[model samples]
Target chain A: MANFLGLIQNENMKIYRRNSAKVFAAILIGLLLLGALIVKLNAPEHPTQDTHWKQSLQQQNTQYQQALTQMKDNDSYQNYYKSQIAINQYRIDHNIAPDRQMTLWSFVENATPIMILVISIFTIIVVANSIASEFNTGTVKLLMIRPISRTEILLSKYVSSLLFSLLCLVVLFLFSWLIGGLFFGFSGGEAHLSYINGAVHETSWVLATWQNYLLDAVKLIMMVTLAGVIAALFRNGGLAIGLTIFLMMGSNTILALISQYDWVKYVLFTNMDLNQYFNGQQTRNDMSLGFSLIVLAVYYVVFLGAGWLFYTKRDIKA
Target chain B: MGINTEPQKQPAVKLEHVTKKFGSKTVIDDLSFEIYGGEVFGFLGPNGAGKTTTIRMIVGLMRMTKGNIFIQGHSVKSEFKQAMRQVGAIVENPEMYKFLTGYQNLVHYARMIPGISKERIMEVVKLVDLEDRIHEKVKKYSLGMRQRLGVAQALLHHPSVLILDEPTNGLDPQGIHDLRNYLHELSRKEGVAVVVSSHLLSEMQLMCDRIGIIKKGKLIGVETVSDFMGEGEGKVRFTVDDGQSAAQIVKQKLSLDAASIESDAIELAIEHEKIPVVVDTLVVSQVKIYGVVSVTQSLEDRFLEVTGGKSVG
Candidate 1:
């Protein structure tokens, strides 16, 4: 285990020692601060809470119920309206506010999705070249001659790339929270209404925020793994990074087009969004939350397995 | 360099019928050889003769299609880590991370193996004579400096076997001479078995204690440097005022064949002993010999002779 950790350290040294990695870190922080500034500029000066919010939410739920009665069962927008009504009812039942507050935690949560995508892109760009760059520079010859096994070498690169992504995420989370607090006064952030399993429940804001970020990162994990496989197979960094980024940006449209078929549920992108089950936003009814998790797990194994097989079995001609 | 030491009984590296194939093409035929400790083994072959491939297999960068290699009595295929722990090799080029400082690159390799201290890293840096610029990035280094740094990295763990493939490529003349001396010292004093591969016979001639010549993916022969160069006869050149007269006088008086004749020189196939007799006869016949020099039969000449005049790539 100690031996393996040293390998990881060596791998991390190669990663963070590159000047581009420092530049990426600086840019990620700058973007987070800039995003908070933009929100600060756009926020309303004062927020008002309605005294009769429960009565208003009750009227909205009645309107939502009538709209649902007139809509088709498979209407894509049905889930959105259903979740909204349930969350509103929960708020009124618990006598909690509607959570339309301009606060630190709210801003942190809202910024997470975009920032996660940015961080994913940065991580992908770095990892795509991790294995292939060694071959390109002819350094793999020396690296492989070490007493460590090739599997361990490959694992170290994979883990280091993930660690880089995690570092970016933690930085974004903490910096966004601090920046949002400076702008929004860090109040009214305790209430977090969560819609789960066709019911609404009040959850802790910090836990909810972390869950939101992690769930949003599922696709990034899958795409990064795919990038690693491509890198191992082709030994070409540019091709791997380019193809994975294209697939990532185009995944939604691709899924929408094929989501009508039963097999589409098994497609990698379709199951990548584990949040679909939690957010009441799934496009297909064929896959349950357990089913998506299983599919994603299977794909993860396949991706990592393919990478291992190629990295270990194939002779390094370079 | 000091006197060449005799190779010890224990072999540090052994290849038994090792073969490598790429797709349907065989790159290395059934090759078998042993490099004993305290000796420098030279691998000589022409272009496309699988020198690089064999190095890769020995270093575990490439897999052999058949047979196996043993380093310090550990099978490379079955006990890869144990086998590799005894070896330090630069398979082809001594390519380092140009973005990293020389010291950082050494540290990067040091972390891969256990029991290497910071003092060891510094010691290696100093040994390679890169201590002055060890903190500078490798991108600023010369090719010779990078080669030295590679040697430093390979020596950090004190492995019993050191393999350098074309280690003299891009090196200055002084650098090559220094490396030759260093390799000799490593084999003689430290009892390390060194394997060096190159197509340049001149470099191999001075540096190698024993050589194995490979042609068309097959090893033709392996012999000590002295025994290999001691074959057949040597050429003697006669620089004279009249080359035609020198050739005529030498053929008539000494009965030695004048291999070729230039305007002011003549070359003769003669034994080392007959050189004085030829010089005496040339002088007696008033040939006016300006110079009589024996042209040593170089390894390049011997290589050509053994390979049947096939070109060296």
Candidate 2:
């Protein structure tokens, strides 16, 4: 056990001191920060009308003239009514763009899921490929003959990969936060929205500070584990990363469009996102956080268990 | 074959009918061998001759399909932890973190062994003669240097048995010689049983007390250096004046009919003690001894003979 722990420590030291990992980390951080800054700075400005009457008149006149022409030719009041209402709504909402700070905060809030997905995919590829690359490099044979059991060696590797994935996510989060904070002040935490239709009403609940951040981190870490396990089982880094993206994206898009199945909601990424938990709301189908957690737990267990079995039995051939 | 009677004497390592197969391919076929305390045992075979497979099984890297391997009477399968406690091995290559320095690699492996002291790390570094370069990253070291560092790491725990598979594969001649002498000293002075597998027959012959020859996934022979060389007489070849006349005279006068005459030399297979008798016979026949040389068969020749000159792989 001590030897196994020593191996994990040694693995961590390699990641920390290796120039390639450092360079890769730096590049990821720089790219993420630059992306955040660019998005923040180049935000589309909200139009403020100095000539509100002129603007309103121009928009209304165009729609009215079109409506009058349509009514004169086909005598259709339906087209006139639709055009008049749409034109009036457009004029009012055109100059009513969201506040700059609010827009940026919303952008970040939406982008976090994608960013976590990207980092998770990258972490899985890097960690999984490192292990597989040892075989290609003929290093695994060297590792196995070290008077230690194969199980301990592989477990140490898995633990090291988890640690590395966490490190990468933390870096991504820190840089994203720094850029978001610098460009758009951090005063948008209590953001919310409300919608009402007929007798139905819905509210966008604000996220609690700790629960939001912690759950997001946990989900991201779990995503990394999923990717890592896929890579380990397949022993193809690119395939693992690509499959993770496909699975996460495909599950939400395809499953959401299909007929609403109660069980499908549990497995789909739309519900997998813990942001709903922070939003203090159930999913469209009213799936609970506990159900989502259970689904994720099942996936995590099966993936890791399969990975462990395959890795232990497969020959460490290059 | 005598039963070991010493009160505390124990075999360093033992394997019985250890067979391992990968799918349809049989790697190690009923292999059995033992290394006694304080002897350097050479496991000689060509590439893919199951040397690595056997070593992996012994080290608990790969489980055997049949039979058992024991380290100091601890079964590798059931008592792997206890078995590994007194065993060390470098199977295919030196497994070290390339980014870590040689010293750090040694320290990392040292810490894993429960009772290993920090002082032992320094001791192994010096033992492998890598103290000067220990601080440099392993990736920066040459192949030979890396091998030495690997040896240092393996020896950190001061295991009673050390198993190395082709430890000198990537080393230069000087490095090979250095490692050979170091391993020799380790076995002799430290009383550590060593099993070193290699394709380099001459180096093994020089260092090993006993050589186990494997061919086609099976151990063909296991014998001491002198025993495997055989008790037969060494060959002596000579070029003498008037070899044809001498052959006729020797065949008639001294019953030298078995002596075969080549283009330039008359060859006589004679024991070392009979060299003088052959010389005297030639002189008595008025045949001048132009040249006389004795040829002893090398381990390579012996191996070729035992393996029937077939590729072991």
> Chain B alone, TM-score of each model?
0.84, 0.85
Q: For candidate 2, lDDT tens digit of each residue in A1-318? A: 666778888667655676768766777777767777777567667645455564655666677777766664332243334444444454455533224343334545555666666666556656666656566555566555445666676677778877776676667556666666666675554333321111112233233222444566666566666766776677676777788777766775686476355566656365567665433233443456677788777877886787777677765544
Predicted candidate 1 versus true structure: per-residue lDDT over A1-318, tens digit per residue: 888888888888888889988899788878878887887788666767678889999999999888878775553567777888988887777777766556888888788888898888888888888988999999999999999899999999999999888888888888888888887887666678877778787788788888887897788788889999999999999999999999999998887787667788788888888877777766566678889899999999999999999888989888
Give the runs in model 2 whose Cα sits over 4 Å from its true position.
A1-5, A44-100, A103-108, A146-149, A186-223, A234-239, A249-271, A274-288, B1-8, B170-174, B230-233, B240-266, B279-289, B311-313
The TM-score, computed over Cα atoms with residue i paired to residue i, of candidate 1 is 0.91
- When summed lDDT is taken over every stretch of 10 residues in candidate 2 chain A, the lowest stretch is A194-203
B1-313, model 1: which lDDT tens digit per residue?
Answer: 2246465566789999999988899989999999988888999877887888888889888899998999999998999999999998887889999999999999889888999999999988887788899999999998899999988989999989999988888789988988999988898888889999877788998999999988888999989988889773477898999999888887887777798899999998877788889889988888888888877788998888887788885
Model 2 residue A81 lDDT score: 42
lDDT of 2 by residue, B143-183 (tens): 78878887777787788898887789778888888888888
Q: What are the per-model C-alpha RMSD values against the true structure?
A: 3.1, 7.5
Candidate 2 collision pairs: none
